[model samples]
Target: MILLKLFWSFFQIGMFSIGGGMAAMPLIQNQVVNLHHWLTLTEFTDLITIAEMTPGPIAINSATFVGIRIAGIPGAIVATIGCIFPSCVIVSLLAWIYFKFKELTVVQGILSGLRPTIVALIASAGLSIFILAVWGEDGFSTNPLTINLVSVLLFTVAIFILRKWKPNPIYVMLGSGIIGGAIYLLI
Candidate 1:
């Protein structure tokens, strides 16, 4: 029964999350934190960290983690089904029409408009993550010095490297995990 519920929950998320992983964050947060009582806000934020350090889409990684955490392996399977069902249905329907209309001028114009909106959505998600990561559980920036100079430097360096080098995202995730772990140990 719980498994069914988990699967259904994820299916809903996948089905309705129009803009992909980033857009799903708010929905996931609402379910995990407010609706289901599966995890607290702090836990939800932490899960984002785990998702980033894992190798997959944020939505999928989050569903898997929350599902497993809530009800072990069975829960994980359920949640994954839920998360994927929406995408599968939507993609199949879209695919049927996509090829036919892809060359149309109106379709092209719509896509061009959508690109910026998608980018804005992604940027908003990033800001949310930044708030969660730096502000901690109380949602207050708890940095002793008001700002972490090292992190800023690292961020600039990372941006520079990424701009100049088309490195695989997985490699970047791994490197970030290592650096985060190192920083944890150091501080």
Candidate 2:
């Protein structure tokens, strides 16, 4: 029953979460954190971080992580399969349709229409992550004491490095982790 529930949850995430992994973050958070109570908000944020740092899609990685946490290896397998199943079917069908209707005005218009929606979804997810990182669980308190200064500093430095040096993201992530670890150790 637990396996079934996990499968269904991820299957829904896969089916409806258009615009890729970043866009899927909210839905994944909803399912795991809000709906199923599988993980806390902090854990969900950590999951996003790990998912971003790892290879492959974030949704699939999240499914596997949640599944394993909930019900071991079998849960992981089922959740992974569930998360992948919709994409496999939908992509195949869409590919065939897209090739056949490559010149259709409606198809082109629909594709164009989706661009802004996708951007909005990505932005929303990014904002959620930013808020969580900078504010912790208290969530955007105006009080100065509530803010996570270390996270803010890390975020600022990361943005600057990304804008200025344009280093590989993996390097930036590693540097941030090292800095965070060193800071925590010192304190």
The most accurate candidate by TM-score is 2
lDDT of each: 0.78, 0.93
Candidate 1, residues 20-110, lDDT tens digits: the string is: 7887787788788878889988788788878877778989999999999989998898898789877888789878878878888997887
Tell me the deviation in Å of residue 159 in model 1: 3.0
Could you tell me every candidate's TM-score relative to the true structure?
A: 0.75, 0.97
| Regions more than 4 Å wrong, model 1 | 103-106, 140-153, 164-173
Q: How close is candidate 2 to the true structure, as a TM-score?
A: 0.97
lDDT of 2: 0.93
Clashing residue pairs in candidate 2, if any? none
The number of the candidate with the highest lDDT is: 2
